[model samples]
Target: MAEAGLRFGIQLPVQSQSTIYCEHWETEAGPAELAQAAQAADRLGYAYVACCDHVAIPRRLAGAMGATWYDPVSTLGWLAALTTRTRLLSHVAVAPLRHPLLSAKQYATLDLLSGGRLLLGVGAGHVPEEFEALGVDFHRRGAILDETVQALATALTDEYPEHPGPRFPFSGLAVSPRPVQRPRPPIWVGGSSPAAVRRAARLGEGWLSQGDRVGDLSAQLRLIADVREQSGRSGPFAVNAIPPALYVGEPGWDTGRHALTGKPERLAEALSAYGALGVTHLQLRPRSRSLAEYLEQLEAVATDVLPLVRS
Candidate 1:
């Protein structure tokens, strides 16, 4: 929970340019712009900065996905040095793409170096060609991911962790510079598929749901609750939601019909409904054509919007 209202984060622009959500300015932006955005998020009190992961974008998806994915570990680790307080998240790293030890080492170093501000959000992944390119079985990725999650749970926390699994087994190998967080960073499983929800309830600290329609969230929440209850998970768990593009203040021009546009007060009232549904965190992606406009939106949220809505 944030000091004021619900905790919020942004999938920082200029990192990943997925056709579905990539912004206009990102195509031309670089580290200078990314750092500026991250630093502003930290200074303005955003909860965390998140980045997406993809080893490669196959030619088929290249047109829509622009083939520009900054490695999450490297991006977040870089931002970790630039900002002091904001948390770091991988949004949804495809864990089945790499061995758990490699992932653990990279993330453990990041967490330890950054004073334990890493939240490892992972997914089973969907890109078949990328899996093929990496020599991982696309059909078995889900099972592979399940095992990897168990392997990470051990590797991230123990100095000499042992994981005897179907693949990637180890008994005596020790990893240096363990994560600063005692049990390692919190893992928020991504995706809203049946397997994803179940994996989150059974293994993760939270669920970063994949854009379940607003009308359907109640059913999904109930399902999560049922699974947690069945799995004996009595501890706290975060349920996340990502709303469509938002234009905080009235744009007079044409912000789309789905865009949430209004005075700060109106936005607050509308957003408060999310809290009623038990959403612990909300990831906001403001509509912007330039870095300056984006930063202005962040400032507006920090000064005007957060106060009225944060609980």
Candidate 2:
């Protein structure tokens, strides 16, 4: 849990990327391995464990890219069972893959089972081919995502939710077992676009920034803050940023671009810079090839890095 007025979290790259920025880290993380990693994170006092949500594997970037992705809902359901404290999240579930009612039901069960420990992060997806493969119109996803957000929120509340929208309609239906979080879960809107900022101000709990671009992150967050203020919402809405990797001590790890690469003093300085910029949460991850390397990175972060900056 956060302080009385603020909340913070970390993101785990649970999809197990084969290569990031064309450099190989861990090529594969099996189901058991993922579960163990989640357990380890819980033991380390992390607040959130987030997984990338994808319906189909994108092709040919790496030879090992096609390995089975552990489904976020199923994986989180198990993670909730395995860990008593850590919250589970889909970093950015593609909104067009599943119907809003079904998505609401799935997350509600997970939230209930996890004792309301669910942060529902959603995104208007990229990857045109993935949408084509999923049999959804790639162009109209923005409208669809808007409807999805509203419908999910409604379905999580009223037993017989009814909506006649441009995208879809739901009437005379009961989506059972409302989420453990009253009204709905904390729906985080991700992306750096203007639309994303407006959406977050209008309907989301926070704006989750992605990728390695810090200048972009700063500007987007400023826009979110400004928009929220224009809308007359109070301050202290979450501004979350995920650094690319926490690979401290790795050769050629750019400390300039990412906050989590460097010795304790340097990392602390970088993190303080984010804090100065009004970042309430900084989500860090370690880039490594094996379990030993991963744990080593985590240990370095816990021992050398965390104490330097954690509030």
**lDDT (C-alpha) at residue 159 in model 2:** 76
What is candidate 2's lDDT per residue for 73-187, written digit by digit as tens?
A: 8878988999988888787888777899899889999999999999888988887878988888889887788889888888887778998876669899888887888777888
- Per-candidate TM equals 0.96, 0.87
Residue 172 shift from truth in candidate 2, angstroms:
2.7
lDDT per residue as tens, model 1, 1-311: 21123787888999999877877789999999999999999998888999999999899899988899999999999999999999998989999999999999999999998999998999999999999999999999889988998899899878899998989999888987889998778888998888888888788888898877667778778888888888887767887888766777877766567778878888777667777787888887777778998899888877887688875
Could you tell me how far off, in angstroms, the CA of residue 12 lies in candidate 1 after the best superposition?
0.3
Off by over 4 Å in 1: 1-5
The RMSD (Cα, Å) of candidate 2 is: 3.3
Error in Å for residue 270 of model 2: 1.0
